[model samples]
Target: MLALAAFFSGAALRICDGLLPRLAADFGITAGTAGQVVLTFAIAYGVSQLVFGPLGDRYGKALVVCCALFGCAGAALACAFAGGFDMLLRLRVLWGIAAGGVIPLAIAWIGDAVPYEERQATLARLLLGTLSGMSAGQLGGGLFADSPLGWRGAFGALCAGYVVIAVMLLARLRSMPSAPPAQGGRLAFFPQLAAVAAIPWARLVVGAALLEGVFLIGALAFLPSYLHQRFGIPLSAAGALVALYAVGGLLYAMAAKPIVRRLGERRMVLHGGWIVGAGFAAWAVAPAAWWAGPIALVVGFGTYMFHNTLQTHATQMAPAMRGSGMALFAFCLFLGQAIGVWMAGASFDRFGALPLLLLPAVALPLTGWGFSAALRRRAGAAAA
Candidate 1:
């Protein structure tokens, strides 16, 4: 049920990638300018972490998730009929705010529910729902943008998905025994967040999450467009190929259990980061359009390899305050993504795609190694 609810959030996050060119054309803006559609949403989603994290602690995580799903539905509905680009951006802000609430809290809920030893595998299974939705949304955005139904239709579909999921989750919520909210009151979430932030390990996980956002999520946003301009692929086709990113994610999801057992978190992050970095490096220099799909697949797998480890850490970072911990981690994450997208858009406009693609390829490996090193240090400290 939680996984099903995550589908719309992932869908809404990536739909703009496929819709960017069409939005640019329709709104008489540069493709870079059209990227504000993504930027606004990301910013709102990031900023929302401040609000939702503490609120979830004060309220029930499941109930917070249910309400936020409805908020996403409302914002998406508004987005469908936005009269101007400005209006669309506004609606996206609302959409972002709502989306901010869902996944982090859901993970926190999972943290509350699952044992640490088994949590990573459970999270991997949940990721399948998100990756599947991302695949459908990315492709649906391109297909809808190309058809008479258009980008608005894509949003309409998102709204419908959110509504249905929200109802289903709400129903599930009712059947379950209610969890008592964490102790707090109005305006107390900030101090709660501060207390969690004081932990050295928590800071390390949050920082890595921020870098991952910028390097991966932010940079990858431009890939569909990169394929379109460089290879002259149709937007729909470009979207289809890039949507394979989720396929890569799906592949990792299926393999996560065995891989976790074999490599554990340290080696997983160590190798996963470089693998993703290498995939992007390949993307920068791929000789032909045919390579896009397979490369995206590889990149997606590495992304999860790196990212799921971070997620597992986030859930446990502040075990007593899991809601605050996850929220802060996600906040910096999308915040980094927003910064990444903005920089990538500028980079694309000024320097072009090579730098945008290659930079992360190089930087991500460092990110992985740094985090893995920290893990080793902690292990050594534990052993001592």
Candidate 2:
């Protein structure tokens, strides 16, 4: 059930990717301008973490997740009914806030329950649900928008999905035992946030996660649009191709356990970064639309390779206050995403998509190397 909620959250985030062209046409705006909706979602998703993190720590994580699921349902329904782009944008903010609580809190709960050695593998399994929803969202948006039901129908479907998952989660909550809140204080997450912010390791993890969002997610949001613009594919076909990224993610998730054991986090993340860079660079130059499909797959696999390592560290950023720690980690990540989308949109308008793809291709590998070096330093410090 929790995984289902995570799936919807992932779906909600990307539902706009394939809808950008339709949205721009509907609202008499440029395709790049329609990205304001995506920006709003990312911003709301990031900021809400500040509130939900504390609530999750004070209340039980499962309880907060359940409540957030209902909130997502309500917001998604509102989005379907929204008459104007402005109204729809506001509803997306609400939906993003609600969606924000599900995944990070789930991660924190896992951190509380599982040993670190096993946590990455477990998270990879959970990632399958999220990635599946992403593919569904990407495809559904284009298909629905092209149908009589349109983009609004997509949100309507999302509302129903959210309600179903919320009900299941409620039942699961009743059947299962929940861990106690890590915190129960009036001051809330501030002190915990401070403690995390004060730690060098925590700062490094957060910084790196933020970069992941900026470089990876920012460019990724534009892939469907790139296909539409460059290859002249139908939106549905573009979405279907873009959805191949999730296939890559699923492939990586299936092999994650063995990969983790063989390469270790440091080496795995380093290669993941380079592989993602190579994928993006290849996508940028591919002469035919068919070639971009496999490139998207490589991007997905590499993304999880790099991101899963960061997520594992995020869960331990503040061992005793993991909800707060993970929340802050998510905040930085999506905040970077918001910034990245805005920048990418502006860049697309001015410079086209080549720089967006190619720049990240270079930066991501360096990011991976930076984190790998940090890990080595920390290991040496521990030995010392």
Candidate 3:
């Protein structure tokens, strides 16, 4: 139930990305302006995790998760009835704030309940829903918008799903154990925040995760519009292509444990970064629509491969302060995404979509080099 709730919350946000074109057309706005909906959501999503993470530590994961889901559902319902573009944008910001807690809190709950050795496989299962939800958001949103039901109806359907998940979560809340009271005052929170900030390896991992967010959210949010503008494909087809990106991620989630076992997490992160960089480059140069599918797959797989490893390391970084650590990790990640969307939107407005792909192509390799250098330094320090 917890995992499903997290999945739906994520899916709801993702659906908005694919629905951008139709929504923009309906509201008589530019694609760049419509992109603000993505920006608003990303910013709220990132910031809210900082608040909810501590709340989970102080109160309980179950309570935090339920409240976030209910809030998300309410926001989605409100969005369904939004009177104008501004109204929908506000609702999206609220929705992002509420939905933000679901991922980090869900991961923290798993950390509290599961052992380290057992976590790889379990985390993979949880991520399956997360990635699948992203895919559904694209495909399902496209379908909803194209059909007689329309974009508003699609949001309504999401609201209904949220309600069901909320009910189940509320019922199950009593069976979950509450976290013990955290030590110190509100000021103490700063120390944990500082602890995460102080760790060199943690900073590197967070940087990589932030880059991952930039690539993932920025690319997915605009890919449909880019395709329509460049290739003149309809919205549904473009959305379906975007949906295919998740197939690669889904495969990586299923295979990640064995791959990590064989290759080691650190090496996997390094290699995955390279693969993603290559994917971005491929997308930049591809001459036809057929090429987009394969490049997107590479991008998707590589992005998630590193992402999974970064998340595992983050959860282990400070076991005692798992909530704060994970929350900070999420904060950096979403902050990167918000910046990516804004920059990409501006770049698209000025230079066009093709140039935007170069940002990740350049960024991923640099991030990968940084990760490798950090790993070597950690090894040398241990040897000394």
Provide TM-scores for the models: 0.98, 0.98, 0.94
Score each candidate by Cα lDDT: 0.90, 0.89, 0.81
lDDT of 3 by residue, 248-335 (tens): 8889988887887897766877888888888878877778876787777777788777777778878887777788888889998889
- TM-score of candidate 1 to 2 decimals: 0.98
TM-score-wise, the better of 1 and 3 is 1
lDDT of 2 at 326: 88
lDDT of 2: 0.89
What pairs collide in candidate 3? none
Write model 1 residue lDDT over 1-384, tens digit each, in one string. 888888778888899898888998899988888889899999999989888988887778889999999999999999999999999998999999999999999888888888999999999988998898899878887898788878899999999999999999888886654345778677688888998899999999999999999988988888888999899888899999999999999999999999999998999999999989999989988999979899999889988998999999999988778889999999999999999999989988788899889889899999999999999999999999
32-68 per-residue lDDT for model 2 (tens digits): 8988889999999999998888788888888899999
TM-score, ranked from best to worst: 1, 2, 3
Q: What is the lDDT of residue 307 in candidate 3?
A: 79
Candidate 1 wrongly placed segments (more than 4 Å): 177-179
C-alpha RMSD for every candidate: 1.0, 1.1, 1.8
